[model samples]
Target: MAVFRESNAAPYLQPVPPVVGDAKVGGAAPHELSIGEIIRRERRLSQEQIEQILQYQREKGVRFGEAAVALGLASQQDVLFALSQQFNYFYAPDAKRGYSNELVAATQPFSHQAESFRAIRTQLMMRVFSQDDVRRAIAIVSPDSGDGKTFFAANLAVVLSQLGGRTLVVDADLRGPRLHELFGIESSSGLSGILSGRAETSVIKQVPDLPSLYVLPVGVTPPNPVELVERPAFALLMRELLSKFDHVVVDTPAAVYGADATVIAARCGAALVLARQGRSKVSRLQDLVATLNNSPAKLAGVILNEY
Candidate 1:
C-alpha cells in the first residue's frame, strides 16, 4: 500500500481532521498522558482553565480537544500537538523542538508535502527494504548541486523513521556536507572521522526528537573527500551500518563534482537520482543516468524534485 499525495496546498487555517494513515503505520501503544494533560502542559493552562475545559467537555458532549478549542483555551495546533502526544505520532507543531521547519515531515506531518515524502518512503520500503531484502541503504544522487538531493534524503529518512524502524542518514558528501545543518545537530565528529580512523569518540548522534532517526555527520572536512570515499573502509562502513539499521540513506556529492557519488552508490547497492524541475539540464541528467546505469548499483528510481 504505497501512498501518493500531491496536494501541496497551504496548511489548514482551522483544525480539520488529522490526515488518515495513523492506523496503517501502526496503532499507537497506550500512552500515559491524556489529551487534556498534554494540552495543559504545552499551553501552560491553569488549574481553573483545566476545570473549565472539563466542564465544557461534559456539558457540550465534545472531546477534550474540541472543547478546548471552543473555549479558546488552546489553539488548533495545540490540540494537534496534544493528539500527537496521545497517539505516539510525533511532530513539532510549534517548532519548539524536534526538527527545524526544513524537515517538513517532522514539523508538518499532516501537510501535503509531508505526505508526499511518506509516499516516496512507502515506495522505497516496498522496493529496496522489504523484510527479506539484504540491501538496506540507498544513495541519493543528483546531476548537480541544488537539485534538492540533501533535502529529499533528509525528509525521506524522517518519514521512514516515522514507521518506527531505526533509520540512519549518512552524510557521505564529505566535500560539502549539509545534512548536519539540516538536522540541526553538531558535526564535530562523523563519517569522515570514522572512515579516516581519527574519531576517538562516538560519531553517530541520535536526533533528539526522533528516537528512531540517527545521523552521521561529516566530522572534520578532509582535504581529500574523493580519496576518503574511495577507500575500502567506506564500503565496509556502509555494509556494517546496513546490518545495524533498518534503513540507511547516503547523501552523496553531485555527479558533476566527481566520481564520488557513483562510487558511493555502488557501495550502497542502490541509488535514487534527483532532478530539479526547472533548473536541471536534460543532457546533464541523461549523462548522470547513463553513468549510474553503468555502475554496480541498482537504479531504484529518478525523482523529479518539485520542491
Candidate 2:
C-alpha cells in the first residue's frame, strides 16, 4: 500500500489522460480509470514497471490486480484502495489520515460495523429521506449517556455522505459537545454561536477525506445550553441546513439531560432513538419514544446499540 502522507493532501482523484488500448496509459475520465491506471497513479509505478506488470498479467491470464500481487508489485490493500477510488467510495485505509477511529465508516469501511451503518443508512433513505412527510434532517436521540448516540450519528453521517450527496452532521449537544473532537475540526464557532447570532455560515466545517461530509460543532458551549437550542433561531438554522444539504444528522445531548433532545428532534422534524443493549432501561426508552411521538417530529425508528 502507498504511504499515508499529509492529512490535508487532496484525496480525490485528479483528471488524467485517456488510456490507449494495450498501453493502459490512463482512463478516458477520472471516474472511468481502469484498474491498471488507478494502481499506476496511486503507487507511482513507472512506465517500464507498468509494461512489466502488463506482460506478467497476460502470461498469467489473471486480472491486473492479481498479476500485480503475484509479481510482488502491489499488495491486496493497494488493489482495494484503487478499486475504492475507481468507484468514488471514500474511506481511509490508513489511521494516520487523522480522523478518529470511532468513524468506522471512514476507517474500517469494509468492516461489519461499518456495513451495519450502511444498512441503517439504506433504511433511513427509504423511510425518512425518500418521504415528503418528513424533513431531510434526522436527530439522533438516546435514552441515556454512553448509549453510543454520537458514535452512531457520526458514522451514519459518513455512510450517508458516501452516497455522493452533501451530508451535514450537527453537534447540537451544547452541554457536552464531542463531534468536533471526533471529526478533528475546530470548535471555536458552531451551533451555539449561530444560534446566539455571534457567528454566521463560516462555522460549518467541511471534513477532510470524505469530500461530501460536513460538521457543525457546538462552538463556545454557552452558559445556557437549553436556552440556545430552545430559541427560534435554532429551528431556522435547521431549516436552512435542510435546504442546503441532502441529508442532515443531528447529535443531541442524552435524554437524561433535559428536554434538549426532544427539542432538537422537533426542530429537525425526525428522530431516531438509540438504546444500548444492557445500559438503556426499557422505561426510559418508552418515555423518550412517547415524548417524541407527542412532538411534530416523526419517529424514524429505534435501534439497539450492541456495537
Candidate 3:
C-alpha cells in the first residue's frame, strides 16, 4: 500500500488538493511531490495583484517574471531562474545530477519563506556545526510531506558550503525518498545501499551547483527499510560521512514514520522539528514530539513551518 502525491506545495491562496498515486515507482514506498501545474498555480495572482505586477515592471524596471520570482510567487525552479536573472548570477549545475542553474534563482514566493527558514537554519548550523558537533547535529525536521524539508536540506547545505564547510545530506527515508529529486539526480544509492553493501563509501554523490553539498538518496525503496536503518553498516556510513564532510545533515525519514527517524537519532546528535502552521494538526505535532522522545537524539528545538 504505497502513498503518492502528484505535486509540491502551491501558494497558500491557490492550493490544489493533493493527488494520491497508487503506483509505486519500482515498488518503493509511497510519497508525494507537487507537480508542475500545482507549482504554477501557486503563482496565480488576483487581477489586482496582476496589475501591481505589471506596474512594478513598468515603474521599477523589474519584469513581471523577475518581480514574481523575487516575491516568492512561483515554484522553486521559477524562483531560481528569476533571481539569477535579477542578480546577475551564475552557478554550474552538477554534471552528474544535471543540477540546474535555475536552483540559484529566487522567486517572491520562495524568497519570502526562505528568508525566515534560512535564518533559522543558519542560526542552527552556527550553533551546532563545530568541529566536534558536526557529526552529531542532524537536522531531522518534522513530518512535512510538502513544506520543503528536502529543499531546506539542499539549500541549507549550500549555505554551509558558502561558509567553507563540506556538507552531505544523507536521505534516510528508504520507504519514501525524494532527496535525489531535489538535485534532479538518480536515487539509486543511499542508506539502503550501504546497508546492503551494494555501494561503497565513494558512491556518495557530490551534488552539482552546491559543490560542498553531497548526497545519498534513499535509493530504490527497500522492501523492509526498518532492518536496513538498524544495521551497523548504516552507522558506519554516518561516521565515515562525518569524517569526510565538515557538516553532515541527515534528512531522515519524516516524523510520521517512527523507527527510521529514531534510528537517525540514535546516530546523530540534535534534531530540528518542523511543523506547518495552518496545514499541520496539533495531534500530528504531538505525535511527532512523542515519537522523538523515544529516540536517542537530543531535542535541539522546534521549527514551526511557514507556508
lDDT of 2 by residue, 1-307 (tens): 0100111111111222112121222434435788887788777899888888989988989899998888888889878977886677766777777888998889889898988888888888888899775565899999899998889999999999888777889999988889988888888877776777766447778787676788888889888988888888787777777767888999999999899999999889899999888789999999999999999898989998886
Q: What's the TM-score of each model vs. the native?
A: 0.87, 0.85, 0.62
lDDT by residue for model 1 (1-307), tens: 1222111111111122222233222244324567877788778899999899999999999999999999998999988877776666665575768466788888888888998888888787777777464775899999999998888889899888777667789999988999998878988887877777776676777786566788889989898998888888887787778766778999999989899999999999989989988888999989988998999888888888876
Return the number of clashes found in candidate 2. Answer: 1
How accurate locally, in lDDT, is each candidate? 0.79, 0.80, 0.56
Give the residue spans of candidate 1 off by over 4 A: 1-30
246-282 in candidate 3: lDDT tens per residue?
7777776676666677677677766666666677677
Give the runs in model 2 whose Cα sits over 4 Å from its true position. Answer: 1-30, 46-51
Error of 3 at 209 (Å): 2.4
lDDT of 2: 0.80
Order of the predicted models by lDDT, top scorer first = 2, 1, 3
Best model per lDDT:
2
